[model samples]
Target: MIQLKTREEIELMYESAQLVSKTLGILAKEVRPGVTTLYLDKIAEEYIRDHGAVPGFLGLYDFPNTLCMSPNEQVVHGIPNHKPLKDGDIISIDCGALKNGFYGDQAFTFAVGTIDPEIDKMMRITRQSLYAGIKKCKVGNRIGDISFAIQLICENAGYGVVRELVGHGLGKEMHEDPQVPNYGRKGSGPKIEEGLVIAIEPMVNLGTYKVKFHNDGWTVTTRDNQPSCHFEHDVAVVNGEPKLLSTYKYINEALGITSNEEDEFLYNFMHD
Candidate 1:
């Protein structure tokens, strides 16, 4: 069944989103060459707990990390380890936080240093696909429309769209109702409604559309062993439009980059 949020519950969700935002902000500053993802995961756990929220991913279903740090060909759910990220490598960091009985989840694929043009293009376009998907999250639209928007953009670029994993609704629990897939036909699936919040993420690869899971049972990688990109945002439908609850501003600010990509979604929030 689909779960809807009340106005007051939405506020609580917003608070949870903010904690996730802050956690990503800190991770942004600490992501650099030679830094181990395991180290970053520890930092995230402490940061979330210090702020009164728990790390939503840790020990949830026996998973062992505060963050899902997938690097290079890894699609998602890659476990953090002592491996040091080298120059030209890209890693995807997906995080979740629980605050005030609500959950916030977000993900970002980042370059360790200067990367190849091909991988860079994959990252840029995959990130753009995330926005395309978000644009479809509005009142009266179906979840399939949002998925189609993402698939249309990413596939047109010759990138492989992962089919196994998916995004999902967010509320008191880390995973809620309505699985949000990255590939679907328009006009299919659940209808969008006000107070409906979801995490729209697109995991695109430079190779085939297939992926394989490691024997460790958590990490997932592209089947062809080529590079992949993943980007995400938590969005809420309000006033007949999609309102973004997660922002990459923290990442951009820390990296000294500037992009007005999210201005459309946060126009009123910026002014207020």
Candidate 2:
């Protein structure tokens, strides 16, 4: 069942979400050519712990890592390793944090250095699709509204939206009710309501949407061996509108990027 959060509970969740967002910002500065994902993972764990929140992904379901680091063709759930990232490679770092009995989850695909223009465009489109989906997360809309929005954008661009993986409602648990898929028919699925918080993620592949599981039982990669991009956000419905609980300001600052793309989704409390 979907557990709607109370106002106080939502406040606590905001704190948890910010912690994860901050962790991603720190990783942003460390993501570069010659940097190993395992090394970045270590730093992320320390940073999250130092801030008084536990690393949400480490040891969860016996998976060993503070972050899910997937590069290039790998879709998600890639385990951290000693392999150093190279120039032109893009890595998707999905992070989480547990604080005050709540969980915050988010992800971003970062370019190690200079990357292929086509790959870069794919990333941009995938990230834009995330917001498109978020824009539909209102009190009267169904989950399918959000899904269809994301799917239409990426599909029109000739990108493949991953089917095996889907976004989920989040609160005390990392994965909760209301699976948010990237593709669906409109007016279908559960109706969105106030106090409902969820993670909307779009995983788009540059080639076919078909993916294969690796033998490690964790990593997932595209069957056509083409690059993929993933972007995510934590959103909540309040006062009949969608409000963002996480911000990319830190990441953008680290990358020296200036964009107000998220301005429409920022909640009033975010400014305070």
Candidate 3:
């Protein structure tokens, strides 16, 4: 069943979501060449705890990490390891936090240092597709509206939209109802309604959409060994519109980037 969150509940989830955003921001400053993802994982776990929220992903599924660190071809669920990140590599860090009986989840793919121009463009397109999907998350629209929007943006740019992994509704539990896929028909799936909270993530690959599971039973990679990008946001439908409960401002701040990509999705109740 799809769990609709109350305004108060959504506010609480926003707090949890902000912590995840802050956690990502902290890691952003350290995501340079020679830094190990395991090291970043340790920093995230400690920071989340220090802020009074538990690590949402750690131990949730017998998984043993605070963040899903997938670099280069790995799409998602990559476990943190001792291998150091190299220049030109990109890593997707998906994080979640549980606080006040609610959950907040978000992800971002970051460039380790100077990266290939083609890979950089893929990341830009994938991130833009995330907002395209968010724009459709208003009242009177079906889940497919959001899915199709994302699919269109990526496919038009000749990118592969990952079909195996999809975004999900989020609330008290980490994952909820209304599976949000990146590819779907224009007028299909569940009808979006007020109070619906979801994590809309677009995992776009530079090659074919096909992916393969690693032997570790955790990491997922593009079938053709091409680079992939992942971007996510937590959103809630309110008063016939979609409001962003999470922000990439923290991450952008760390990277010295200033963009108003999220201005349209800001909720009135949320303070700056």
Instruction: Give TM per candidate.
Output: 0.97, 0.98, 0.98
* lDDT tens per residue, model 3, 155-210: 99999999999999999889999899999988899999989999999999999999
* Model 3 residue 110 lDDT score: 98
Candidate 2 weakest lDDT stretch, 10 residues: 263-272
Superior candidate under lDDT, 1 versus 3: 3
Model 2: colliding residue pairs: none
**Candidate 2 whole-model C-alpha lDDT, 0 to 1:** 0.94
Model 2, 202-234: lDDT tens digits are 999999999999999999999999999899999
**Residue by residue across 1-272, what tens digits does model 1's lDDT show?**
77888767766777778778778888989888999999999999999999999999999888999999999999999999999999999999999998898898999998888899999999999999899999999888899999999999989999999999999999988888899999999999999998898999899999999999899879999999999989988898877788888888888888888999998888244332
In angstroms, give how far residue 176 of model 3 lies from its true place.
0.6
Worst 10 residues of 1 by lDDT: 263-272
lDDT of model 2 at position 250:
92
Candidate 3 clash pair list: none
Candidate 3 whole-model C-alpha lDDT, 0 to 1: 0.94
**Higher-ranked by lDDT: 1 or 2:** 2
